[model samples]
Target: MMFFCCSFMGAVAQADCLNTENLLKLDAQYETALQVGSVQFLDKLLAPEFYWVHNLASLQETKAQLLMRIKKPEAQAHQRRSHDVSAHRLGNTVVLQGLSSVDKLNPDGKTLRTSRYQFMRTYVEQQGECKLLAVQTMKVWSSEGN
Candidate 1:
């Protein structure tokens, strides 16, 4: 079975994006929230109308659905490690793009599977904090034995 994992890299100052630092901080917080399945943190970080598109199945989920899904007892726990993360500013919105490796875990917390993915998350400033607006992800298919 496949699952989701959240990961983030440290902030890198960028002149092009004025809110790079703030965005990076939010990103890290989001990763932590996902890692630990903190519904409250996700509630604060995601806008009411936030939408997420999964890498596999093209499944679309709302903030509420995502919260409920993650809160399930049988939900898989996994770790994500991200790299090559970068942020771009588009008007008042910030788009974070990165590559992540997700390790699916068994009941005992042992890794069962690992997959690579590329994702883009859009964020906007809301109430003096960054909130996720939308997210799109695509799995990176292995090219081995080609």
Candidate 2:
């Protein structure tokens, strides 16, 4: 219930990541899905062979594992947002760099802590659509009561 709705894929199929506006929009949708545990939406956002090098988990995880974890209520973040979304086009692929902010809150909806993560994601454009290829993330830092 913490995450918002996940009807954002319409733009994903049409707007390639090479367009910064589209990239940022998808980025927002991605974070929103994570916060809400929208596994169905995530399944479509990821490519067939998508994988993630997640430092928080200390290992590489496949798309299936990622989706399974999202089904657990504990995996959903109280609040999550990604910023500094920059796209660099490389041939038909785009490498995106961004910082994600995750806030852990108490029952009163007050943030008890905040964590920042740096992530690099790859998107391969094909047939006028951008497919998410892979993502690597590392926790940059954490602060109390942010």
Candidate 3:
């Protein structure tokens, strides 16, 4: 019975696309949440112990602060696009690295001070769920192309 159960579990694991498809869906949801300023979804997507470092060398922010910013009107004025995103999985932990281009609008969706950036984010599984744990972002020099 134990061997059968193990085999059944292995088959289920093989059938589950949690590592690939689910991760991609989570990534898309994250971006969409940011764009629409959905604080609830953002809160659920990030881990309780999450931390983020901005490109301007600012202090890290906690999950609550991040969610609060997303709910703010000012956050709606900033637009961010992430490109060249790549993900690597080690067991249940995933690391996503990407290049980003940002445009802070002047309350009119007009691009202001376009900048390029490099970002690294870590995601881990907790309580049978995947959540973003940490992020680090650095500004790219002018020569790096915005």
Candidate 4:
């Protein structure tokens, strides 16, 4: 009985893998949510255990903290774009890697700050839906560019 139960759990886990296309779609949705500062939209995409490490920092922000920051209008991204993004699938998880660029603008329509970073995000199937699990990023470059 124990062996059968374990086997069943393993099969269920194996069945939860997401395809590359779904990963790309989810990544797009996440980027749009960040640009628009849509906390409610992001809330559905990120798993409960999701955490992000920014710019190779020791500090890690959990899902709630991330959403809280996104909810603040001042912290929103004016524009964000991804370049050279690649996706890899590993069993039940999909990893996305690429260079991400973000722009911040002042109320006067001048560029306040521009930043670029290399980032990796992991997504996994949870409760029959694809959910973002974790993110790690390092600053590739940044420019005031004003």
Candidate 5:
């Protein structure tokens, strides 16, 4: 009985890691979408009730609003890269926490702004697909001393 229980627990642990890994890959695709302002990619990845809290404005945007912004002609391209990403699986939900650096480019393709941020995103599985539910980001003011 003891051996059976140990094996079952080990299997559960391995399953959790596998789930986390899958979510991490999805999160990477999300980062790419953000950088390129891919509305189509975002539409597929975001839940209908998705919400995002921006780091600079402290503003919250719904899925529709976010898609609208992405379609704007003046919208800048964002080059974002995530680092030290960690995903935690909670049943059908996964939470991703990471640090990211972003470079914002103007419509003319000139670099306009750059910043580092810490972000947390939650993804929920629905209909055999994972979608982003909510995300919140905070700017990292100074990495110099760290």
Candidate 6:
């Protein structure tokens, strides 16, 4: 009986792997929407109280403010890519860390503002469903990019 219990526990431990592929897909959708200057996906993904901080050290932006910005004509040609994603799950909390590159095109694409950023996201299981709770980002210039 003890051996059977140990085997069951081992199986449970192995099954705890967090499937981050879906999260990566969501990240892709977000980037695609940003490149297309469309806020549709962002609107769906961001929580009502979502907050975002830009790499330029600007103030945090709420979901409504972000939506407004993305809807403007000047929002075109913004591209982003996420890499080196690391995800961890502990009990009912999940954390995601990744590196990102962001580029916003200028009038001639010659003045593109590019930067490398690292982000940490936390999700909590609320009422048996996981939902994003907070996110933070930091900018860095690295020769060996992500």
Best by TM-score: 2
TM-score of each: 0.76, 0.83, 0.74, 0.80, 0.75, 0.67
Q: What is the C-alpha lDDT of each candidate?
A: 0.68, 0.78, 0.69, 0.76, 0.71, 0.62
List model 1 lDDT by residue over 30-118, tens digit each: 66566667787687668899999987756889999989888874553467666788998877688899986666665565436666779
Ranking by TM-score: 2, 4, 1, 5, 3, 6
Candidate achieving the largest lDDT:
2
lDDT for each residue of candidate 5 in 29-51, tens digit (9 for 90 to 100): 66767666677777867889999
Q: What TM value does model 2 have? A: 0.83
Tens-digit lDDT track of model 4 for 1-146: 32333333344334543666546655766776788777766776788999899976856799999998887888788888887899888777888999899887866766567889899999888766677899998887878642
> How many clashing pairs does model 5 include?
0
Model 2, 21-127: lDDT tens digits are 77777767778887888887778778889999987668887889889998987678888988877888868888889899887765566545778989998978777
RMSD, every candidate, angstroms = 6.6, 3.4, 9.0, 9.4, 10.3, 11.0
Minimal lDDT window, size 10, model 3 = 1-10
* Per-residue error (Å), model 6, residue 133: 3.8
Whole-structure CA lDDT of model 3: 0.69
The TM-score between candidate 4 and the true structure equals: 0.80
TM-score of 6: 0.67
Q: For model 1, state the Cα shift of residue 7 in Å.
A: 18
* Deviating ranges (above 4 Å) for candidate 4: 1-17, 106-109
TM-score of candidate 3 versus the correct structure, residues matched by position: 0.74
- Which is better, 2 or 6, measured by TM-score? 2
Residue 86, candidate 2: Cα error in Å is 1.6
Candidate 3 lDDT over 1-146, as tens digits, reads: 22332233343334432476566656655666676677766666678899999877676788998888878767752556778888898887888888876566544555465667798888887656677899898988533253
